[model samples]
Target: MDTSEFNHGHGGEPINWERAAGDNAFVFMKATQGTRYKDPWFAEDFAAASRTSLLRAPYHFFDPQSPYDAGAQARHFARTARAAGYTGQKPGELPPVLDIESALVNHRAACPPHTDARQVAALLRHIEAEFGVRPVVYTNHSFVTLCLAGDARILKGYQQWLPAYQSEPPRLPGTGRDWAFWQYTDRARVPGIPGPVDRSVYHGSLQELRSMAGIRGNPPER
Candidate 1:
């Protein structure tokens, strides 16, 4: 599960971390937007999730159209995530996520009129360089096909978090490639998270999930 500032304000309710953990939900929360905004509840929410023993990651909302340099945005995300207690030292914890979606284009006034795959690549490179592990790429199939023009080969080394809210699985762009995490529905009713929430499933076992996150040992006999 993942959440953003939009999910922390008036219309949103605080997450019941204990309940979520009990449900075996690993949580990822948005920590920054572009190169400017920071999610206000990041500190509190991150700490709460950690205390509940939930595997956690902090994601950045990438805006290729933003005037800010991709490198700068990457630096901001790294800084914000670190401050929020993501040390990138534990394999049990997920690496950062880069969320690129069509909504970035829909908000044209704030973002540029066009999307740049190169800039997106730059963001990915910077994060990987800073953290020593590749960040997960979260995007939909259409955005990958249209905006990226099916040219996101730069992200081939990283895990893909594809969101296709339908009965069937998502159709990936590149051949011989598959999703590591699939956000299958946005109307899921999970315990602890108030109202509807986006729900995702990992492609493998708990041990595989840990390995993908860069953890090397067998999962602690949980």
Candidate 2:
């Protein structure tokens, strides 16, 4: 759950996989390295770790500009995963995720971002079309409320992965927010990874969670 799971260069030091050995159930490795897979090393390393498991799919931090939408994201996810060496649905893994957050929502001078609900939905669709598995949407409560509220119609078919650090998720009436995974905490201690990382444990059994990630078997020792 380390937020930097998607970032490549971080102040001269890449994230330590030792952090992956914490109590967290899932480690979401960022699929994009500034808009593309962070690189084989990141994915391979996380994929190689043991203390924790990774849903090795690209994170599409959607761009609300120009052509930002779900459809565009499907292509991004599918194409990126293909480029990164991921194949069709696996038994115990979940699908890709669309990250629509501050990086994309605010576009601050310090942050490089991507956002576009329509483009994202498109990208997700494209990913599912290519892999035959659905993609999940990852975002905070505010982003969900502001950006995705109206777009739920297109996303109802997909699973929502909420990035909220709550004991229990807030009920979203009519939002159809029945989430696939609930990221319970931002602060987590994992093994194999070095330092305190943002972590999230899944709410369901290992079987249920794995099914969503599209990883058929227990990921290889990571």
Candidate 3:
């Protein structure tokens, strides 16, 4: 599940973390936005998820046009996530996610004008330095084609988390890289999460997923 404070369960109820664990394999919660805004629910939600069997991860909403620069945003995200208890090195914890998409207001723009490929690459590098693991990039096809066009060589090294709402598998980016995770829907009806939740599928087997999370041995039998 890819979630933010706005995705709190129906009626503004707290998400049932234990029940979410039953229906989901992992959960990525929004931690920070730009360099100043921190998701208010992150601490509580992440602490709750830690007690469950779900793999826990944190993500940042990158504001490519921010005047604070990529390094500042990276530091903010890393610090926020660390305070929320996600280290990226913890067992069953995936690396931090860089949510580099169009700004909320520009969602329908032909090509988001705020996105910068160079800043994106710099943020990813700074995040890797802070977290000690290559960060996963959460983006869409349009963002890559229109915004990150000239940065394929820099982007190919990191994993991609794509959002493509179709039955068929998402088409690979021109970067010649395979998607690590594919979000197929934003209206998924999970048992524990009321209303709708974004659901995604990891591209590999459970064992492979564990390996990516730095877990040794096969995943525990369900």
The list of candidate 2 runs beyond 4 A from truth reads: 2-24, 33-41, 50-56, 68-73, 102-117, 148-151, 211-222
Worst 10 residues of 2 by lDDT: 108-117
Q: Tell me the tens digit of each residue's lDDT in model 3 across 122-162.
A: 89899999999999888876666667663455578778888
Per-residue C-alpha lDDT of model 1 across residues 49-92, encoded as one tens digit per residue: 88875678989988644544888888999899888788666655
Per-residue lDDT of candidate 2, residues 1-222 (tens digit): 644543334443455555544444555566553233344454555455422454544455555444444454455556666665565455334566666554442553222234435555566666667777676767555554565553455566666677666566654434565766677765555554445556655667765666665545553443
Report per-prediction Cα RMSD to one decimal: 3.1, 4.9, 2.1
Native-to-model Cα distance after best TM-score fit, residue 87 in candidate 2, in Å: 2.2
Clashes of each: 1, 68, 0
Best candidate, lDDT-wise? 3
- My TM-score estimates for the predictions, one after another, are 0.86, 0.69, 0.91
Error of 1 at 15 (Å): 1.7
> How much is 161 displaced in model 1, in angstroms?
0.4
lDDT for predicted candidate 1 compared with the true structure: 0.76
* Cα TM-score of candidate 1: 0.86
Task: Point out where model 3 deviates above 4 Å.
Answer: 65-68, 104-107, 110-114, 169-173
| lDDT for predicted candidate 2 compared with the true structure | 0.55
| Model 1 regions lying over 4 Å from their true place | 9-12, 65-68, 104-114, 214-222
Query: Could you give the candidate ranking by TM-score, starting with the highest?
Result: 3, 1, 2
lDDT of 2 at 16: 53
lDDT of each: 0.76, 0.55, 0.81
